[model samples]
Target: MAKVIIYPTTSLILADLVDRMGHKALVAPEAVRDRVTNPEIKSPPLNITPEEPKKGLKYAAVDVPSGIRGRMALIGPLIEEADAGIILDDPGVLTGCAGCNRTNELVRLLIKTKGIPVLDLKYPRDDTEARGFVARIKAFLEGLK
Candidate 1:
């Protein structure tokens, strides 16, 4: 079975979907806040934070949802080391997505498994968009097999 890692919101939607399909969808224990911004990122929120830098370097990891953080930081790496990795996370920065984001705070660090692939889901958070998102994920899983 392919190891599917999804965003927290997406993870809730697909919780039963993965089980019904007999694939393991790991909803892990870490939070979205854990995917904190590294000091190197020169962007706002991450960059604008008032945290002091330690010799020009600041460790700004924060607490996020348990769903996406554990997968990106823990499960994704594990899958890569043994089996192939299939990461499923929302590409959008909005929608109150409680997980690792495009600024790639955590994904950049752990996604080293060569065969692993990270699929950024595209949709409008509407019915049609949701269907399209599922369809895209199905296609992605098919490609892995």
Candidate 2:
């Protein structure tokens, strides 16, 4: 089965779709679920762990912005390891904390460099667009197998 990277890694719909198509969906944030939710931490809002400089160095050794590095830590591995990808490019809806312009651009670049088949689609605004979005994704996933 192909390993597919899904952008907005938190999207339930995309993840389900990828699985339904018999492909393994790699959603980066899910990798760190334990860190984001801890029942012991009573305050529900503060989900993030403090950034470590050593971890940031993985994406860029010198002069790397912490935000990009943090994003890379979650996503870089998935992008590098993906056999295929689906990008839901939506600036309107809050995709997640990974919506930073520079970080989004960097992720796209990394996916491109991986030279894997990618299905890039904008987030649907209407029923017609939504249908097309689903169709396109289905087509892409099917093509992978």
- The numbered model that scores best in TM-score is 2
Give the C-alpha lDDT of model 2: 0.75
lDDT of 1: 0.46
CA RMSD of each candidate after superposition: 10.2, 3.4
Clashes of 2: 0
Clashes in model 1: which pairs? 30-66, 31-64, 31-65, 32-64, 32-65, 33-62, 33-63, 33-64, 34-62, 34-64
Worst 10 residues of 1 by lDDT: 51-60
- Candidate 2's displacement at residue 64, Å, is 2.0
lDDT of 1 by residue, 26-49 (tens): 444332223344456455443422
Query: In model 2, where do residues sit more than 4 Å from their true spots?
Result: 34-53, 97-99
Q: What Cα-based lDDT does every candidate model obtain?
A: 0.46, 0.75
Query: How accurate locally is residue 115 in candidate 2, as Cα lDDT from 0 to 100?
Result: 84
**TM-score of each predicted structure versus truth:** 0.46, 0.78
